[model samples]
Target chain A: MASPIQENLVSKNAEYASKFTKGDLALPPAKHYLVLTCMDARIDPAAAFGIDLGDAHVIRNAGGSARDALRSIIISQQLLGTKEIILIKHTGCGMLTFSNEDAHGLVKKNLGPSAAAEIATLDFLPIKNLDDAVKGDVEYLKRSAAVPEDVIISGWVYEVETGKVRRIV
Target chain B: MASPIQENLVSKNAEYASKFTKGDLALPPAKHYLVLTCMDARIDPAAAFGIDLGDAHVIRNAGGSARDALRSIIISQQLLGTKEIILIKHTGCGMLTFSNEDAHGLVKKNLGPSAAAEIATLDFLPIKNLDDAVKGDVEYLKRSAAVPEDVIISGWVYEVETGKVRRIV
Candidate 1:
């Protein structure tokens, strides 16, 4: 006997799986380009880059910090066979609002002191300028990770107000 | 004297930063939910979960596998002060198209024999069933690394065909 939650889950899964016929499935490209960007509503990668649905792998996080996106970067390159990486940090990011002290206080208030302490020790790469931040992130990916030397790593800044992307480095 | 690349980067950064005033900044929140999903074009968490920008930290990857997004997840939780984690894997993923053998062959052919050898050792968790996969990933997150036990971890499967999400235990 299935619980109500389990039954609901099965129904939902069945509906989602219905679109695909097993015979119609095709493998994705071996070499993929992974883009690490911010989840800001203003920065639209598809429109700016003229990217289609299946063209590039986009990994988005807060502030579009490459340090935050490093794990996915490794997996995308090593396990998923992506060669190129593009770090797209944008202007008007919410990350620039708070200091490390504010972050610690918030964690302690909501999650308790123990979790807050753990958070304090974590490294956060701050951005003074969006273009420099994007470039630095690209450099970090190239140098810190196991990405191939020939990998075309690039950095770009998406202007939130103007809806333009300028390749930084 | 700055290189051409550095000069271009500096000018672009200055141009973008000029649009923002000091008042546009928002204070950091008391708690953050770090979410990991896939780069599948069909899945949209904001519409499904009613989460706005700056509400939760979302990290996306190719398979929506936790291992692939582990680095971003760590940074979001540890550095950015997110207390809870929600790992979402969706149905009808492109990742399920290729078997491990096929992936190995493709990487070998394109990248090189050594690259293929390295990729073969990588643990790319493939899921035939979406619900089971979500639950399994949640369990994996609990066991692996420095993830907090009391972090209120949960897993959900987003059905691409129907824009609906089913919470999996």
Candidate 2:
């Protein structure tokens, strides 16, 4: 039996597929750019950032950490020809709420020692300041050897409270 | 001066924020689940997967690689209370088009030897078979010490040609 969420997926997907017509969209993003943003439940990158169905790649993760996203970013650029990256972090992010040690301790408490050992050395990439995080990710991408020098890179903070995105770097 | 893409973001974000009202949602996803999907341009997790604002976390990376998204997944479950994982990869993904060696060669040619050397040991996590890839990721999550055994994990393939999602595991 499917979970309730999975059942929701089936019915909603059926609804979406019934009217879908952009089946012929190409593998490469049509506008040759990508958006890297937080996986925050409240932020919808396509709606807020004005991305059409086939316009750009949307890469989301916890905190929208650029270091964590470097692998995906490289593949998006090298293999698929994306030339621009818009990296957006956000205000009131969970990354700003805890430290790596806190995460380790939580795993130990929540899932016991085995889980703790599995992630003992992992860095959760927590953020100290929202503006600095955005600036830092943009700078990291700019200096990354894997990222081409000429590729356009910018950073922003998405305001979950207001749904506004302001440029940060 | 901002890039054209950045300009688009500013204008579009203004439009979104002008009508925004859902500012009271909590930090943790209300539905306590996450959707891990490909960063492919054609896939919109919100509309296709039936996720409302503040409903679930959405983590996207190249090919929706489970390994690539491990950290974010850990954070989502351990800290944010997500109990289910819906991992979805899609047909016509760019990841289906290249091997790790092919990616390396493209990097070497496009961004020089230094760029290639930086990612020399990095696995791009390319997928060869769609169904096996979905099943493999679901199995990986099931067996991983970091992911609790009680977490409900399922895998699916989103067909870009038809916008339909079918379960694989």
Q: DockQ for the candidate 1 complex?
A: 0.15
For each predicted model, how many residue pairs clash, with residues at least 3 apart or on different chains?
A: 0, 0
User: B1-169, model 1: which lDDT tens digit per residue?
Assistant: 4433334445655554565343332323233666678865454444444444345666776678776565456556655566777677877776666555665565566557766555457544555667777887889888754566766777877765555666775
* TM accuracy, model 1: 0.60
Query: Candidate 1 — what's its lDDT?
Result: 0.61
Can you write out model 2's per-residue Cα lDDT over A1-169, one digit (the tens) per residue?
9999999999999999999999999999999999999999989888888998988999999999999999899998988889999999988999999999899988899889998888788989999999999998998899889998899999888888888888887
Highest-scoring model, DockQ: 2
True-vs-predicted CA distance for residue B7, candidate 2, Å: 1.5
lDDT of 1 by residue, A39-139 (tens): 55444454444443444567786678776665456556655566677677877776666565665665566557766565567544455666677777777
- Which regions of candidate 2 fall more than 4 Å away from where they truly are? none
lDDT of each: 0.61, 0.92
Per-prediction TM-score, chain B alone: 0.75, 0.98
i-RMS for every candidate:
8.2, 0.9
Off by over 4 Å in 1: A1-31, B1-35, B41-57, B62-87, B92-130, B136-154, B159-165
Pairs of residues at least 3 apart in sequence or in different chains that clash in candidate 2: none
